[model samples]
Target: MRRSEEQFRILVQGVTDYAIYMLDTSGHVSSWNIGAERIKGYKQHEIIGQHFSRFYTEEDLNEGLPDIALATAFRTGRYEKEGWRVRKDGTRFWANVIIDAVRNDDGELIGFAKVTRDVTERMNAQKELAKAREALFQSQKMEAIGQLTGGVAHDFNNLLMAVLGSLELLRKRISADPRALDLLDNAVEAAQRGSSLTQRMLAFARRQDLDLQTVDLPGLVDNVADLLERSIGPAITIDMRFPARLPNVTADPNQLELALLNLAVNARDAMPNGGKIVISAREATVAGGDPDMAAGRYACLSISDEGEGMDKETLDRAIEPFYTTKGVGKGTGLGLPMVHGIMKQSGGQLVLRSEPQKGTTAELWLPVAQEQEITAPVRAMEVQATPEKRALKVLAVDDDALVLMNTVAMLEELGHEVIEASSGQDALGLLEQNPDIDLVVTDQAMPRMTGTQLLGHIKERSPSLPVILVTGYSELPKDFSKVPLLSKPFMLSQLSKKLAEALSSAAAAPDEDAAEAPAS
Candidate 1:
């Protein structure tokens, strides 16, 4: 019997995972096993006389949990729970613990037995799983929003094209009357602003085509300084600073300008009492270990505002779409989100720093590239070709009636033979029936068939027929070979430019691929 008791004691003392120990009736540790020492980071001598409460966190101890657990165990003969517990090194862990009342034959309590197991690893794994699930949900939500935004942009562009075309025609017809002309000009200006707003929405939705190229940061900031100053008014002072010979970055200059304008506007609003705005730029290196920045040289552009800054909670969610503190009708809550999308799409990073009562600073880190001077091509004076002599049989296709009529009017006004088709099928039939058709201009978004699909069909049959696909959404298949693109809401001059370019290319020797053309 004694040998068996000794063997059992040895088995209990050999454990190193669970913290198995004994506590006296007074709640002081009375005996310690090797498992207790290993799990709790304490030696037998050091912990034997210590109170069992030492294993609990301060918050638990303050709530008299040690005494309560002892009372529960003594009365009910057991206690079990899992929660955060402290170790000898002050590190906290999720721990599973159990206590049992020890007693004599008569059931009088003598002491208590305790066991604890650290479960921090399991807790961390669970947290990571939850985070991944949330991230997946957010990704799906953004994709849905993108689809919706693209559909709306397509419809909006059709309406805008009609409004813009009418305004352009009206300006010419009413130019003789100064009062009427002024009204037309104002309407045109408003329509242009609306076009810009639509583009901004596309930016936020990450659908806008980003024209990334080498850009001189110093020159860009200098050119925009006057505009920024005028826009913000004299009440707020504007300052510019740049390091000598800052490296050029790869970005879309126009989009960067818009982003800067957004930041300036936001800064101005933040400082309703008027304050200083500082625009600064420098070339810096992102270290390899940075989690958010790739290891490379970058042009760091920072905009600082001396205004009431955001608190921690606001700063945390500042980049979320449609989230804003601005009251209704004052903001669409897209400025920061759009800027953030721009940064990500540009292969860069955005850093925002703000503190309550202090000012805010927004930083854009654009990847730096090898120094390359960009030169613009000089155009020779064109012998003005009369549209009537250069006129070709043109096909204009669009689903919207008003837009199709506007396009026909514009084509006829340019002295070309206009053929109208409302569907891609109609366009194909027109091409089949009319062998004299010179060019095909088709809208991309349609009911049954898209312009790209129509382009493919036309190319298969008439290999050399020049096709121009018009779209507002700034994405297309990679294999859209040799086809030209024209953006919606185009004016006569813009249409003329695309047509002239396409006609010139079509007149060349048989080419298998359409020449890559820029959208106007």
Candidate 2:
């Protein structure tokens, strides 16, 4: 029996991965093995007579946990848990612990056998895994929201097209009547506002068409500085901190300008007491270190404000669509989300850093453009005076009846004979019936047959015929750039310009084999 006991003691002493020890009835350390000395950083001579409660944390001791643990083990024969525990040097580690009640022949508890294993590394890994899962879930949820917003924006833009188009045409007819013109103008303004709302929504969904250009960061900020100053009001000073030689970035000049203004205005709003807003930029080389950004050289533009900053919760949700912290009517929560989408679509990322007392900094990470020099922004073609051209038969197609009617009206107003088709198939059937139809103007989002499909069929049949694709949001083919595109909710002048451009191009290039080719 003595040799068996000696072998058991030797076995217990051999374990260095776990701290194994014994406690007296009163929870005093009675026996300490080599494993206990190694894991707990204590010598057996130093710990054997010490109270086992010394191993517990201060809070645990204050709660009388040592006594409770011993009592539970005595009553239940064993107690097991995982929690934060302190080592001899007072450093905390996550520990898996077990305390088993020890008894003699009479079945009375004499002591407790305690075992503890440090599990800090395991706990930290689990925490990281949980964070990764949460991040994935958030990404999926945001993607779903973006899709829903994009769909809604598409439908809304179509409706606005009908309303705004009708109001624009009505204003031309009612220009002589001051009161009627005023009401029409008001209606037009309201419709335009709704159009703006849809544009922001589309921006957040990353579906907004961008006019890409090489933008000089310093020059763009200079151009918008006065405008931003006016928008944010006095009291706040705009400070520019661009390096003398910063590379231009590739982005839509107008959209990037708007994004900068939005971020500036956000900073202005954050500071009610009036503070300096610092706008700075630098070139940064990103390795695969950042999770949100791919490896590339980036022009990092930062807008920082000294204001009451956001808490972690607020900062976490700052880019959520339509989540505003400002007073109602003072803000639209889409500003940040819109900026976020623009950066994403521009092959960049928006990173916001904030602390509750230290204010906030919004960083716009835009990919560096190949062109070192800033190029001039392409100006929109100005609507010229009506030029003499032979009016031709035009086929107008749309799924929405109101939009079709308005489009037909606008076409007829432009002196073109209009034939309306409610769908792409109907448009094709009409083309078959009316072979003389000189041009096809079609909406892209239609039931049964999409505009791209119709364009495909038209190309297969009449390679030289010109077709103009009008859409709220484009999901066209790779060769779509060859085809003329007109965005929805356009003004009459814009439509006329597109018509002229399309017709003129078609007239100029008659022999191109693609259906996207223009007629002779």
Highest TM-score model number: 2
Q: Pick out the ten consecutive residues of candidate 1 with the lowest summed lDDT.
A: 377-386
Q: Which stretches of candidate 1 lie over 4 Å from their true place?
A: 171-190, 235-247, 276-300, 311-313, 349-355, 370-389, 459-465, 507-520
lDDT against true structure, model 1 = 0.83
Model 2 residue 277 CA deviation in Å: 1.3
lDDT of 2 by residue, 74-191 (tens): 8899999887887888888888999999999999888889999988999999999999999999889889999999999999988999898888778777658888888888888988
lDDT: which candidate is best? 2
Tell me which residue pairs clash in candidate 2: none
The whole-model lDDT of each prediction reads 0.83, 0.88
Where does model 2 exceed 4 Å of error? 59-64, 74-77, 88-90, 175-177, 371-373, 381-389, 510-520
What are the root-mean-square deviations of the candidates from the true structure over C-alphas? 4.9, 3.4
Q: TM-score for all predictions?
A: 0.84, 0.91
Candidate 1 lDDT, tens digit per residue, 197-294? 67766776777777777888888888888889888888889888888778789888878988999899899998999999999998888889775678
Residue pairs clashing in model 1 are 482-514
